[model samples]
Target: MSWKPLRVLTPRSILPALAVLLVLLAGAAAHANKPVPFGDRVAEPGGADASPVTAQSLDTAGLELKVGPGLEAYDPATGEHAWSYRREGATALYLAMAGEDAVVLWDDGLVTSVRPSDHEVRWHRAVPGLAEWLRGEGETGAAQRSETQRKQLAVERAAIALYTVPEASPWVAVVTPGLTMGFRDADGDLRYNDRPAGNCAYDPVRTVRTNYAVLVPRTCTGSGSNNHQAFGGITGYRLDSTNWQLATGPAVAMRALDGQRVQIEDGPVLGSRVFDTKAAAPESACGSRTEVFAAVRPQGTCAEPVANPGP
Candidate 1:
């Protein structure tokens, strides 16, 4: 696995996109603001409010995304409205490709899979919110306030990531403000509800998602009295902290590419390397990185394996 420079994902701010099917689970409160129909407020393509929509629109071919008060999808070739999905106050948090679809995660818990070509909604579903996840925490009002604070912190201090697992059919990791769960992207079926990594939280922030695994920027906070220490960056534990990397520096950038792989840019020295998380081989002999992901260039000569060509 000779580490080579390549690009697969987009910067987190833009939410990387691919020419495939898109399944997005964006959170929408039951009592959300009044609907803002598409075209009623088509953001001027490159306005401040349209930043989120711009990236998706440009990256995805044939799909025109107009996001302002609402999100609308149009057929660029025909200049026709294929479909329009809008909610008053929901933010487009994360986006990634999953096989023939793109999986998106929203601040609220609404998930919808839409084919960009024909703009057909294959499946859509909603998940629980932080307040609902912690239903047993405190009074309803207090719980809602607590969840709000966590969300604010997530925006200011941490990042939200959307990860897609193309294995066994596509499944999207729905990381809400409370828990991390997996849902089949093909349909809106719940695949697995994940446990909070030992002392760290996967919701709101503190957790990062890559195609192969979920990385937790582990901390004692959000563990709810766990009080135990945990790994810092790029956690290797299936659900618990078993192995790790980037113990000191700040969190790195990562994005999902097609073919069930992830490209991570650690720093200038490392440049960027696309890891074959699906590679069925012993880990790279040089970089003692996660055994499953085989990449990361070394300073010296080491045993390197053939990497599956990038798409």
Candidate 2:
């Protein structure tokens, strides 16, 4: 499947556990989420002399720039380290280009936007992960956890999703259950902390992040109709600016067209779907609300229907 892991089906008994999980997140999330308070609290890299270059590139072939330990930038042609950024226990997870800057996501849930000119971390924030929420609570304490338990936590952690609006544009989004936040690419400011859009199910795996929007599966939680697989529709949350603005899209995304439009591709979708709770099914079925979908679009989706959002 294109999704990471945890597309699961559990007995209804798990609902109580899931409820507890959400409660735990509500408190712990607030405590663990710490972004750059004043933007400059985190020291910036000094001038060229402060760089970590072991040696200048002797080869003239012009090698590719690579990210190594601690998000270090190196020239593959000569093994020259141009610069490096590191956090004690954090490990670099992935790196993507945000215009001229490089945004790095760390395993510890920290997202940093760095300027390539020098080794300046333009802005950064720790987006809470599922692991953080469940870290050291009553039944989920670390000391008493088993290997299997840790693996399960890791799998859930992997489920935290992200979406960068407009491809390389600076605005980057991070999503975890019960919470969502957006970090601006220009100066590392985070302005969003709610659903990008819609009343879609809370299943993170069913959500797809695109360059400009996040498409989430539709559901009628307490209503009385079973979610029609294909017709459930989707609520797209676009990174319109300081926050996620609600928008609409097809049930499934087919492909991107020439400009701001995308080619619709899904089975016939009738009027809005009606979910029947009395149809009789495990609450766990909600976890698999929608089918698998590809990752975020490289070029993003249609342009935001709204204009420039404020800081």
Candidate 3:
């Protein structure tokens, strides 16, 4: 009997299939290790005071947020909750103090003022169909607007921009979804201030040094052109009383284009680069750089100069 020579599989085809299988397995393993957002992990904790008042308010003296179901409140330095209210149905969107009253707006659109010391419902109104409006079930949906009603409400509510004039002030400005501008007074009353056309973003990320009481919204629109220029300065709102407007003249602009990967040295980094194109123009150069942390593509060449110790 003649013995036939055994054949070995070629490395090319086998390696690709093995790589694909390994990639899928790696993806599955990574997915299993994903973390949940902080908000989802905890239940909304309700407050002790459950009063029913017509109109009330509280005085906030240096406080942080304490959340609960359809309710949120500010925990003052004295450990007493200043503002407490029930928003939506078991989902509290926001909690603010208007005088001694706790102003609450839930996901469902029910706005109510509750006595903080004694959880009393002072005044309550279902903004026509706010709950349905929020859930996207009503005819108006998310973008529904009642221009006359909005204007009237603004005047009646005494809404002010949420930000304070000085960085030292304890005042906070809040804007209702209906575009109502209001300020919470030192006594914590939700009084209508003035209305501005532009929208403002919350500084929850703490990216800016300004204590986010309220800020004038700054927007930069860029067509997807390679000609990206940096704004020369940082422009902020020049607050006049309860109102806020952008400071005139240009401000130092940071490049905000997406897909921007920047190189950082070993030490602290003050600014960032949005993309390789934007990286080309630097008003200030980074100090003598250290090594970068990146993996090269398999069988790919390094596009930029790399660090090499001289002999």
Q: Give lDDT: candidate 2, residue 19.
A: 93
**Candidate 1: residue 193 lDDT (0-100):** 67
Off by over 4 Å in 2: 1-69, 130-160, 167-169, 195-200, 203-206, 209-211, 218-220, 224-233, 239-259, 263-268, 271-311
lDDT of 1 by residue, 54-90 (tens): 2344336556654322345556787565555444466
On TM-score, who's better, 1 or 3? 1
lDDT of 2 by residue, 42-117 (tens): 2233311223212211221232333332455556646555555665555444565666666766556677776666
Model 1 lDDT on a 0 to 1 scale: 0.48
TM-score of each: 0.47, 0.49, 0.31
Better of 2 and 3 by TM-score: 2
Candidate 2: C-alpha lDDT: 0.49
Q: Ten consecutive residues with minimal summed lDDT in candidate 2?
A: 274-283
| Candidates ranked by lDDT | 2, 1, 3
Q: Model 3, range 190-269, lDDT digits (tens) per residue?
A: 45443322332222111121332233333233322375532212222222343323221222223222222222221133
The TM-score obtained by model 3 is 0.31
Candidate 3 residues lying further than 4 Å off, grouped into runs, are 1-66, 72-90, 96-102, 122-172, 176-180, 183-213, 220-242, 248-311
